[model samples]
Target chain A: MRRIESCFQRLADQKRKALIPFVTAGDPVKEVTVPLMHAMVDAGADIIELGVPFSDPMADGPVIQLACERALAHNTSTRDILDMVKTFRETNADTPVVLMGYLNPVEVMGYEAFAKAAAQAGVDGVLLVDLPPEEALDVKPLMDAQGLDMIFLVAPTTSDARIKLIGQAGSGYLYYVSLKGVTGSATLNVDEVASRVETIRNLAQLPIGVGFGIKDAESAQAVSRVADGVVVGSALVNQIAENKDTPNAINDAVGGILSAMRNAMDQ
Target chain B: MSERPDFSAFPDARGHFGQFGGSFVSETLMGALDELTAMYARLKDDPQFRADFDYDLAHYVGRPSPLYLAERWSKQLGGAKIWLKREDLNHTGAHKVNNTIGQALLAKHMGKPRVIAETGAGQHGVATATVAARLGLTCQVYMGAEDVERQKLNVYRMKLLGAEVIPVTSGSRTLKDAMNEAMRDWVTNVDDTFYIIGTVAGPHPYPQLVRDFQCIIGREAREQSLKQAGQLPDALVACVGGGSNAIGLFHPFLNDEGVAMYGVEAAGDGIETGRHAAPLSAGRPGVLHGNRTYLMEDDNGQIIETHSVSAGLDYPGVGPEHSWLKDIGRVNYVAADDQEALSAFRELTQVEGIMPALESAHALAYARKLAPTMSPDQNIVVNLSGRGDKDILTVAAIDGIEF
Candidate 1:
């Protein structure tokens, strides 16, 4: 089993829900990303969803979009994010790191080359926000060949037919978008998410980590009741955005919010 | 490249047009695309769907748009006969309405209660809104904030047609951003929403479906050309912005061995300056907005910000079919700088008494250059994709005048 599957298995044995914190790899600055990744793990994050900044993040709202702009302004590429993962592996080898982004950068770099390089960089999983399983024929095999998990997002609108296909294709835990709007947009209905997560659980055996619209620790705690994992993105990225110029403060700021959510989920 | 490709076999069952187009969306959108694909496949041959589409084109969209020979402009050029396929005369003042009407009909048939689209110049937005209004469907059009500022009149036009125009303010604040926003909306509202993509880009079924709908331009132009010029034109030219208009005119002529095809891109300042949006002319192949196509990008694989005086032609990527056609040596992709397009826009207005859309002016500008080099017996048909009425304010600003 991959690190992601093992991580989920360990959590399931302990009867503990996993806490996943997402942050853009090069948001604010590149020099701060490795430190931030380490900090996220130290803050009791079971998984670190490192965002590889894309020029156009269609699934994201203004918070993550602006985070991408800040990262792009520094000309941060997927290679750089992979290098950051390599750096994180120097001190940490157990915490699974998932590189999340759109499909263009990996596509431009040739899927085989990216998968090979990612394996060399000690990457555990990849979640291409735009690449559905139907179109992942070229990239998925390469990632699987390297023993890397290919994660997928299941939205509230995803039908049961597609959920079965996603279950068959995807290897890592599925990320469930909790709402109908873009990430960072308001209004999370816990009841609706729990019901959909139930449906998804019945279809796919993989752990479901609910992302999007889970802003605060309270919301994360609520989502953790029905989800195997809770992913907090915009709220952490908002802290990173708030502490952009002061790179030293980002670790504490992102760590503080994620630590609160981790504690809240653990409770 | 030596052997000609079978155009009929394109976009194989997997939606690969020579490895250029595919469904690159997330799982959430993949199901929606599959449903859309099945619906489009079913209705493509349905008699009722065909009749409804034809009725809209003829009565609602004013089909058989005149194939007027620009005699005065041709004489001024003094080389070749220049024929204008006046798609600008359509009800919504652009060929964009052709695809919109067809998609709206599909939306109605699919029992979708709403339709959404992304637009840069607002021409597509207005056209989509117009169709939705006539069909009594709720419409929402995503446009870039910069475009909303530049194309204020078109923004108002779309709103008047009952669309909620949402201004996207991310990623250089242009058409690419608007498309991203629209895709987000579609993923969020997949149950009751049908996304009417305004270009020949995006995932599968969309490029094919849009082409099938807009193919009327080429069909009408072909019949008119045979009637007026007594032969197929030497060349067919149209501006390409995601290449809907150009592909619309060029798809029907792909099998005509004697007729050459040119797809023009907007060379904003000049391609030399590296500030233009002429991806096919100067870019490399990459994936963006769902398909692998020619794209302007930086060395790090990030999409480069593109510029163009015409909002419609300002995207960093072109259509996948155009990319396939370019690679196979079937279509010659070219570019027209902003100044050249403006000059053609002015010349066509003053000389031919028809003001063309800035997007169409690119084709006219290229035609002007090519027409001056050919014999009078030879002819070139330029797809006048839209009217300049929506672009009057932008054109007026260049002359130090304001509305």
Candidate 2:
């Protein structure tokens, strides 16, 4: 079985929700990413979404945007990011790593080549913010051929028709944006999210991972009740931003939040 | 590139102009795009909406702008007779108001009480502000921090017109970044606000609607050309930033088999220097700012910073329809360096007493080169897209004058 499918299945058997931690690769520096990924998994992270730094990140709020700038400062390339995943796969084999960012970088590398290289590097899935299922006609087949899952986002405003389309095209879990704004913007109403999750469950059979505006342990716990997986991005990236000058503090600061959320979800 | 069989039927149902244009935005904005598309489809052919739009254009915008013949400049060039499309004479001193008015009417029809826009040269901001003030809608405009500093007069104009100008400080801090901020705003306030995209770009329905609204420029020019010159001009020239003015003029004359079209891009220093904004001349195909088009990006698919003397022409991508037009050999994409455009700006001021905006001067620069190669009996129509009054400070700074 593919790594993403197996990872989710194991979490289902344990009767616990999945905890997903996201961080931009090569932020602060390149050497710290692989270590951080391993440390997050140790802190109860089931899946890791590693952001490939792009010059333009429109959907991200201030936190992830700054993280991308810091990563790109060292001139991190897509090849370097793939190498990071390959190194992480050396010691860790259970946790799935998903590459997330805009589509231009992958377009620069060509769809077929990126799919092959990512699969070889032990990457499990890809979620490009700008590429909807309508524009995924060419790349989806290439990714499916490599046994790599194509994850897609489902927003609160997504129509029933598009949900059906995305459900058919996607392979991994669906990312449901908890709010109407960009990542790291204001609060998410749990009741509203619950209603949307219920609607999405009726239409698509895949596991739903809710993201955007998930700041702390309490919010993550609240989301854990309604969602199969809780995806936290900007909150962890903010920790990296606050401790960027002292790189040693980044891992502990980021891991602390994931650990706290993990404990709360387990309770 | 091979020629497409038909130019009229484009941007089919899915908004793809032969795979160049599509809705490549985040899922959050998809519903908003769908709503806007549905509304526009209903109103585009309605007689009442057409009559309302025409009434505003005639009295409010001072339309049917003259097609003045630049007799002395053409005679001095020893080439084709040059006719200028006086879009500079429109309200707000540019062709930008034509689109803002059209979109402002759409906002009125939809009962949206707030409007937002993004600006590069500040022309679009001023135009949007002017319409928003007239319509009594709360308006906000996003501009790059760098542009706010350079275009202070227009910034003050926006404020005077009761529009809030928000300075965006992210990314390369220019037009593309401003657009990113606008999209963020729309995604958050999709229920109450309408995003009036300034050019023929962005996601679907915007390119189509903005093109349909601004097509008045070409439609008017075609009729005026037939009356004044007794035939369509031999060729057409317009500067391409996001390519609103160029496409507006070209789309109406698209089916005219004998009329050639030229879309001039800004070559900041030169195309060879890798520092210019001429994507069609130098860059490759990639997606940016919600659509697939030619882009100025690095090897890793990251967008690179583009340079241009004219702030309005300093974008890294052209309109998607321009990409399709170029691919199908309908429009000749050309470039003009800063020095060449500057000289054209100065010469038109002295010879014709009409100082063209620096962005429009790029088109004039290319026209100057192309006209001399053709006979005097031939004609070239240059879109003087905006007046240079706002650029006086920029010209003075270059000439070492304080005021």
Candidate 3:
């Protein structure tokens, strides 16, 4: 809890929105995963969210789904993702890493086992896209006991009563979806998101991370101006997918976006 | 030396024919799959569930549809006799209602108050919405926006049944996209909502549960065939679109070695044109929508868009169990192109006075071709999977004959 608090405190001190870059482990190639994490950190990514590949990812769009298919082709598993995190921690321990995915892989690995494995892998948080706060109560205690933050998504449709429940239960930061549809959808209601984030902030002090449709530097900047962190997922995954066959294209594309978003957020 | 063929068994423990059925999903969905499996196991023995399902099958959906002998068509073909299993007469104009009724009962028994489904051609959506309305459960259906336009009447029917139809405009904007959206809804509302999968696919219990529900088709056909002809038909035929209707008609005869099972898939153009949905005929095994099945994919393993005159048959993948059956050599999977199916669609309407759904016409086309080769003493039973009332406009548009 203190470590989590300090992570947020550092964000406050910086007075700049944290850049959370999400990448599916083993996307282009399985072997490049560790180096990719290091590259993102070097490129000024504040927090790294490693996506565990699942066969059916309902919340994702074609970009992430394609990335997941690429990862699965390489036989990426929960164990492989955890091992990648462990290797990531070996070089840089201060930077927080979160596992963002659906619940099936974690449930398959068993809750206690996943919690322990995640902690051992130096994972500070987890965000199960499909698990609502009410349904998460069963697993939240386990993750909380293991010192792993269980991040929850607060959409525009979320009621005030539900927002209070999610805010109280969620740890690390609250994920505010910028749209009603799945990831990579074009419609982004910035005003709605800002107000929803403000509404959620009124209920809790947890850092707010805005994502879903924050595709470009301008959108990231717009979101970061209000929220504590800006999550760039589908955009990065889309870049990786377009350049999957090219050599070192993923790193350059992702690095460029992160640099641009980081600069924009700093402004 | 090759071993002698034998076929006196049901789906093996893994829901397979030989190499066809097995649970192939990521570990997270195992619990839900297991829960469903356990529920199905208990429900199989529960007299109340069976009684309720039987009641609905009989009175509600108007089951025990006649097994009519098509004497005129069979005599014209000058070969084997042909028997029609009249699943088209089922309520909502298709055999889809059989599985829907069974699953709706299971949903109610499981204490789920809401039902969600995905549709491609809208037949399954209409059936699901119809049952949900009857049971007083809230229903939501995800359909591709393209499908919504092509199947506008069925979409309206679903809305009239008090169900919300969500148009999915993602990915290919077809059946696969609708499936992705539906899966998302299921994951979000797993606790209180029952996902009424429309076919014999998805993770474990769904394929098994749906097949069991639809097996009534094969079971009734077998009894009726025996009573009418005093012997099993030489060939059993049905169209394969995710393999539900085919599986329903084929499961009972799976044990009869002498009975040949033919599952016809849609070849939109010719297979050479690369615009077909013939999974078993030309596809590789890959994971999609929770199961490892035969799917049309590119070299990079990305699923490719498939085409058929019938929107229902325009899915890239076939049921995994069908893949197993093909592997074991128990079922001969064949393809019928759009022109062939269209001709059969016209033939059935003109000769038999029955207009078959374009999806089902593929099997009728194949059966018509096979009839000329068989002896007069032989008999073939074709599953009339659905009525063509929902597809008249589609069929007419394709033929440049506006209705």
Candidate 4:
């Protein structure tokens, strides 16, 4: 937790908004996933959100949903993701890796068992998209006891009162959905999201990361101008989907997009 | 545990209907579901809850929705007597509100400040939004982008009811995708937000919980039918999307050896064309959305995209209880093609002066076909699950008739 806090602090001190890149573990091929994580970290991702492939991913856009489908087709599971994280931690102990996915697989695996597996695998945080703050009462304590950060998402439609509740319940940073739609949707009101992030900032001292519709460098840069971090998911997944069979092309495409977004934000 | 039938109310301690219902979600959601199951067990029987729910059903929803005998249509079919369970008269113009009202009240009782749900035709979303608005709770509804565009009127209605409509643009951009997004939201917000599932599908408690809430449909139909005809109906017919309405109407008559149950599924083009949503007819048993049930999946076990003229029936999976029922041979499942359902939609509107949602028309079409074969004195109860106001645009577009 302290290491994660410092990562955010360092990004703040450097005047650089954190770049949190999301990738579904075991996409394209299970063998490539750990190498992809290393590649992402080497490409300057501040935090890595390792997406556990779920059969149904409701909050995802077409790109990530397809990525999950591909990963699941390859027989990826919670154990496969934990194996990826364990491998990821061998070289990069300081980079925070967050497990983001739906709750069914985790529930099937058992909460206490999952938390223990995650901790043992060197996972730092988790974000189950359908587990609301109130329902997180039991799981949050388990995660807390296991020293895993319980990440939460706050949508534009979230009420102020509920926002506060989520802020208090969430650990690490808050993920603010930029639009009132699923991931990969194109219409994003960045100014509106920035203001919402401001409100969240006032409510809690934790770092805020904006996601959902940051599809390109311009959008990512715009989001970075206001929020503490920018999360680019659908765009990256789309790149992966377009070049899944060609590893170099997949890496090149994602690297190009990330590099451009990073450069734009740095300016 | 005795062989004697238990007429007890729900959140059935072990979560079963004679070896059917039980919690099947991921371990992460088990504790929350267990909490909900326990809370509902306590509240369902509590006098205060019973009184409050009864009052809402009486005044707010204007329930005990009339059970009308369709004399003209029954005569035209030239067979068994036909009766319609008027769920379309319920508030929000569909049977979905029955479960929404019960679940929303439960949410309030559990001290949940927010509610989330997934919608296909937007009936459930509208119903949920209406109840949430009345209760002054924050509501978020996830709908597929295609549904948002196709069911534009309902999208606006949900927004008007003060619920946030989040369009899911993933995985076929239909009902299943919307379900995925709602599940994501529930997992993320599982602490305080109660997920109001639109259908009697999903994992253990939801299938049982929704059926128990919607069983009011069967309970009322049975009582009213017996009072009017002095006997149980010979047949019960209802369309199966997620199978909530069908299960609701069928549960009360499950043990009646003489009563035949028919669940009509949507055949988009035809079952032979491989473009349909007839889960029981075309699908194999598989686990999806928290339950092990029959699903239209490929050889790789990936859920396939289902097509139907009625947006409500375009789902790859049927409710788990439906799976069990099909396995036990207690209920027969059949399919009605898009063309057949469309003709029935028009036939019912012109013959009965009632515009039925395309989903409900599938069942109506099946009833029309089956009525001619039944004896004159036999009775058939058709569940008119929803009104067709939401389908005018789609129907008009299909007919190339602009207002």
Ranking by TM-score: 2, 1, 3, 4
- Write model 2 residue lDDT over A102-221, tens digit each, in one string: 999889999999999999999999999999998899999999999999999999899999898888889889999999999899989999999999999999989989999899999999
A1-267 per-residue lDDT for model 4 (tens digits): 355678998888898999899989888888877887877777768898888877676566667878898898778878888988999889988899999987656766667998999999999999877666754676899999898998888876666676788889988998887775567876688879878888988887679998888888898899999998889888888888888888667766777788888888999
Number of clashes recorded per candidate: 0, 0, 4, 31
**TM-score quality measure for candidate 3:** 0.70
Model 2 lDDT per residue over B183-207, tens place: 9999888889999999988889888
**Regions of candidate 4 where Cα sits further than 4 Å from its true position:** A1-55, A58-66, A69-246, A249-267, B1-27
Candidate 2: DockQ? Answer: 0.85
Clashing pairs in 1: none
Give each prediction's DockQ, rounded to 2 decimals.
Answer: 0.67, 0.85, 0.09, 0.10
Instruction: Estimate, for each residue in B1-403, the C-alpha lDDT of model 1 and write its tens digit.
Output: 5677789788888788987998877666777788889998899999999998998789988888999999999999999999999999999899999999999988988899999999999989999999899889999999999999998888888888889999988778889989999998987888899999999999888889999998999999999999988999999999998999999999999999999999999999999999999999999998888888999988777898998999999999988999999999999999999999999999999998999999999999999999989999999999999999888888888999965
Candidate 1 docks at the CAPRI level of medium
Docking class of 2: high
Global lDDT scores for all candidate models: 0.90, 0.93, 0.83, 0.84
> Order the candidates by lDDT, highest first — what do you get?
2, 1, 4, 3
Could you list the CA RMSD of all candidates, in the order they appear? 1.8, 1.0, 9.5, 8.8
The most accurate candidate by TM-score is: 2
Output the chain A TM-score of model 1: 0.98
